[model samples]
Target: MELEVTLLGTGVGIPHSGRAQAGLVVRAEEPLLFDCGAGALLRLAEAGLSPLEIDVVLLTHLHLDHVSDLLALAKARWLMGANEISVFGPDGTEAWFEALRSLYPYLEELDVSITIVRPGDEFSLSGLMIRAGEAVHSLPALGYRIESEAMAAVYSGDTEPAASMRKLARGADLLIHECSFPEPFVVTNHSTPLWLGGTFRGAGVKRIVLTHLYPQTVGREEEMVRDVRAGLADETKVEVGRDLQRIGV
Candidate 1:
């Protein structure tokens, strides 16, 4: 089967000119979406993909920047005559969706389906196996490792340096991790090049793509990439993820 991954939005909370928020699409046996931020649906449309083509949507956390477009996508699919879309996320997902439905009375009566996920759980859909692992973030968050016959990818949803993430991404073909800050910003609940680069070096992942860049990352991309390369050795491909960029594994 042909496997492809697309970076829909690489920006953090604040959107940039060529970047949106946090979103990615992994297309294999079935299309799986990760993190539906503000402009994700539009980005998907730009990629020529319809909401109906997405079978599953995996959320990293309950943060507004990560899941702002959840209801919009759900409602779009329902209006387009598509079947219920499965959603996997942290502990509070069920409650979040319920609260969202309450606001949109039309959605309450829709035939959409929701499945709240927990960490350390494994499941299969569309001939692919997915495993959810723990992520160190403000709220309960998860990182995912998706595997199939020919390729595999690990997505680190907004997290600080966590050993669990390294274990989850070990030997994966691609690791999509967040680089929220440049370095030495002294922020909590976010990753910086200093922290994230060190973790990636120890993790020894193949091909690291940095996303979820904050505005602070501006004018410091080269330095961040340099630090990551210096830590992980030259062979590790460190690239800044751009909106609408596609990669095949």
Candidate 2:
């Protein structure tokens, strides 16, 4: 099967007309969801997919923008007569779910399995090998590298450029990175083109899809791509990712 990726929501925590929130679907033998933030379920539908079809969810962190749709997805699946789903995330994932369950109480009834992972852990799911690496963010975060037999993709969750992320993305066919702002904005725990491009160049990534765009960054796509091009090798392809855009890996 071809490794395919669909950008479900390319927007950041902030709302935008063209973009939703942080979400994507990776299709290998099975469809896996990464970072199901606000409006993710609706975007999944827009992508011509059903929430019940996604059994595995990989979260980079517990940021609300990256996980606001967790409960919504669970409820949707439950209503559809599917209950079993697995979640994998960085440390504190289980505890965070527990806290949510405590407040909602009904979450306890959802048949979901939560796994807490640490940096450097490797695991297999849906015939794909996935590895996690530390990410520099406001909270404990992880960047994921997923590989099939001949294809690979890396997701740089909400993070600043870091060595671990660079190592994880090295040689990947596609690097889906979060570019929350344009150059010289200097936001904490997020990336601008200047920092992201250097990391992408250092990793020698072949193709980059910039997601997690903030409103201010939407109209500056050309400038961001130009800045990244200035830092990266000419062979490296860079493009702005939009919701529902699909690419083959």
Q: List runs of model 1 lying over 4 Å from the truth.
A: none
Residues 1-249, model 2: lDDT tens digits? 479999989997779897888899999888999999998889999998988799999999999999999888988898888878899998888888778868877656787799998899999999999999999999999999999989889998899977888899999999998888998898888888877787667577889999989999867999998887777756789999988999998
Best by lDDT: 2
lDDT of 1 at 193: 75
Off by over 4 Å in 2: none
After TM-score superposition, what is the CA distance of residue 119 in candidate 2 from its true location, in Å? 0.9
